[model samples]
Target chain A: MGELRLMKGNEVLAEAAIRCGCDGYFGYPITPQSEVMETLMARQPWEETGMVVLQAESEVAAINMIYGAAATGKKVMTSSSSPGISLMSEGISYIAGSELPCLIINVQRGGPGLGTIQPSQADYFQAVKGGGHGDYKLIVLAPSSVQEMNDFVDLAFELAFKYRNPAMILTDGAIGQMMEKVELADFKPRWTNDELIEKCGSWATTGKPAGRKPNIITSLEMDSAKMEANNKRFQEKYRKMEEEEPRYEALMCDDAEYVIVAFGTSSRVCQKAIELARAKGVKVGLLRPITLYPFPKKAIAELSCRIKGFLSVEMSAGQMIEDIKLSVFEGGCIVPVKFFGRLGGIIPSPGEVVKALEENFLKG
Target chain B: MDIKDIIKPENLVYKKSELLIDTIMHYCPGCSHGVVHKILSEVIDEMGIQEKTIGIAPVGCAVFAYNYIDIDWQEAAHGRAPAVATGVVRLNPDNIVFAYQGDGDLASIGTAEIIHACNRGENIVVIFINNGIYGMTGGQMAPTTLVGQVTSTTPAGRNVDLNGYPMKITELIAQLPGTSYVTRQSVQTAAAVRKCKRSIKKAFQNVIDKKGTSFVEVVSTCNAGWKMTPVGANKWMEENMFPFYPLGDMKDSDKKEVSNN
Candidate 1:
């Protein structure tokens, strides 16, 4: 245990990563996420922990650096915001297609272009869906507070290695800059790179000489048959991931008729709405998804079987609602999956969410 | 294990076949990349680092260097090999790491990476091939293209009026404190090829010694772009390229001769 100290969310993540024994960090300075690199550079872990930190030329170069380091079976990471992340999409697909394990953090801002630098959960689809080309999914962890930001960095790396795929810590600008008291573990490296390579070297890109042919580390296999085999290997791994990685938390859902579902920063607001609605004799409950990709379908469906209707709330313009509809009705039930929210950086207050619930879930 | 055994003509040393790739070479017949690749393979064989060396190729005519070299490789976007190599080598310092780049890829596009890697004193070998022309893009002017020399982009004979003069990359990098070895050698003549091999080998050896940033800037020929025969191009590089780019070791702190004059 360490002394309780207040820190920004992104700072907490950078500190946790160093403590976790991340060997490489390549990132370009971008707002909201700039602190991640600044703290890492000032810390100069290169001399002490053999941690290498580089300010990459661009987001594209940064992610590719992660790809290269990851090929050596190192726990490497990179962080960026909206436009910067959009640039990393192509590399993300390549890393995923290569089946490399790494962590990427996106402190999401409003988007489509140079969207506002304010907080927004509009990237929900981008985080869960393959934000890049090809078939892939990032194990997206949404952090609502500084504590979760600290906690999720370790969790993201754990899940990344466990599934042999990329994991994303998807938060918003508020979570990145806002301060909160955090209790972090004293320094201890979880595992060395040799340990990671020993477990993953069969597919790694470490060079082999005359007696052994050189290893080819590429996502491009012009041969359709070979490409299909690679896809199959990833598919089986993803199936195993789906079986084990779904996570969510429900509040006051035991005796409710209407369920309000949300996640990340929006989930906090939705929980407040659920409490306020119940205080007024309105039966309401909240379902918060900790893992956005493995969208808690089974649990939501079981609850759907009991509730009258499901009200979807979020900070995005109806992005997570689509997944909510699929999860709520996957069990063959016909409950209406209603939606409500704002777009870009605008967030609906709990009062506004309660009103939407009354109009959509309660009155109906 | 011997150099001759590794570089046998019939063995397809660096690859399963030949450096004469079937990928429709984007380079002219006399472009020095073919020669550079042949010698690089020979060096890899001699040092016994083919198994340990990871070659990161930059975007240029040599984009397919990975295909020709018989070792592990990952293709990097323009000017990014130094950064990418940094990632790989930092993770596995025991493994040999190198970057292959042309003037355009290393000097213009990746200048930041090349300079920073050297400044940070990263232990890696960088082979910088300076042919004075963007050979891949059909004889376009390059950062290393000499003043008063003509190319596609500088058709008016690289006048000092509009077009800037050549960039002395090796000379500039030698100024950085992180560099332990930097040489401006050439492969123009048979005699020079022997010297070039020694220069490239020393660069790689410095990396093995944990010495920071070893750079070899080879003043190469681009006969296809120069519109000259192979023999004439070699002579032209001797007369024209050598004067502006110069030849020999620029800086090597461990050995004698402080500068490559």
Candidate 2:
């Protein structure tokens, strides 16, 4: 509650980055998310806070830049859409392998291959599952509103540095382009050189002092035994994250028989859909997942015991519903799990969601 | 005098650079990489910048460069060393940054990264090793492989129609306005090795002075990949490689000042 302003999601993201003391931003322009770099350029954060803003030659270069800076234990970030993120996957895998902390924002558009520039949630599997070559996890956060977009920048950095892993704001074109009132955070000073050394001196690639050994940041381990040991350490950290990080918002779940599961913009639609379903004397609830990787599995599993069925509403072709079914199965519940989605950048409406739930679950 | 008296401190004439660790290098016998690495370590030790230098190791035979050079390092993905060095230098401008890359890593898959990094005029050093063939991943045709060179991928000698011609990437790099110094040198002889060392020192000095990109290409040999003996490889390189990839400075911003003065 530092200051209030009406801004686009992309602009708020850039402003929040400066306010949160981000060290650098390296990005390439892609439609539906170009405003992110555009806004950073217009703000001239370099003049104000010494934040390094660079328009890289391509997404591949941008992500590698993030890798280099993050190895020095700096709060660096990049933003892009689906195709651009795909280009960054190789670097992302390297970043993950090196166990460096950084932030990535994907304002996703529809895509099998540059499918559309409009809103879509088609990257859920790619984000939650491993999109790159190796077995690694990116702490994924889904923000449904412009306010959350402004807030998640700081939160993502905090969690990333806490775990020494990459974190991503898995948003979409709808929230990226839409305008809303956001309460911005207060300005925090960027870390001084002394502070950076104090925080990251143990593992970061800051220059070696006279008394210490050189720090080498690499992912290549020639020996299979050592490589397996490194993989085990990564998996252990992910398990701790799964135990401590799953977040969700449960709406009217006290006495509902059926629940609508969604995230990001689709979750907003389900909120309205819940009201429509209730007015028709149908008992419905909403379970909105905020962290997609440390998914709200426990909550969904608990809900499976009481709810008659779950309708996973998404803007893709039945991707998240598989997770819902898995949650129910893990919870030892035999409840029905169904999916309703719109593909190719089409956002499902409240009325359409209500109709889909009735036709898929209640009718059967 | 006794042999023990000759080995005393006062009689010492040469010793290994302290900047190089005791770890044995994995480079093949008579490989040019070993010579270049030794020279680089000596330069860093001479300048006393070991505590302030950060090196980017590219994906090739030099991937384990961090093991040999006692300095902070980041191992970049294939062809991404320039981009990674850009990240390090922009954020930590006080540190001397450099990228060590191979022919395949720089001239082919990473063409875009090297070109854009130089064009942006990033204040960093680029050490390019052009052996004209891929040595780490078996003997394959490299972007800098000579037109008539025979490799695993080009067994019948490179066909102009299929493999195109050897890339003169250093010449392209010299054309970029962001570059302040660009040179091509070799390591076939003791005199040539000294010359290459001078060029590398100059490149590092340029970066320290905040001059734009400094590039030094060392035309090298790969005996195992070339299917020749160590001595034979050096003779073959002098006979064929030198004529195509001639040694000498291609561009020097400092020369402009000397000429003007």
* lDDT (Cα) of model 2: 0.94
- lDDT per residue (tens digit) for residues B96-174 in model 1: 8888999999999888879988888879999989988888778998888888788998887888778877888889999
**How far does residue B161 in candidate 1 sit from its true spot (Å)?**
9.9
Per-candidate Cα RMSD to the true structure, in Å, reads 5.1, 1.6
Off by over 4 Å in 1: A1-6, A38-50, A54-58, A112-114, A181-194, A206-212, A228-240, A297-308, A326-336, A362-364, B1-31, B48-51, B67-70, B131-172, B221-244, B254-261
Looking at model 2, how many pairs of residues clash? Answer: 0
Candidate 1's DockQ is: 0.46
Best by DockQ, which number? 2
lDDT per residue (tens digit) for residues A153-210 in model 2 = 9999999999999999999999999999999999999999889999999989998888
Candidate 2: list runs displaced more than 4 Å.
B257-261
lDDT of 1 by residue, A78-118 (tens): 99998888988977887898677899999988877998988
Q: How high is each candidate's TM-score?
A: 0.83, 0.99
| CA-lDDT, candidates in order | 0.83, 0.94
Tell me how far the alpha carbon of residue B80 in candidate 2 is from the true structure, in angstroms, after superposition.
0.4
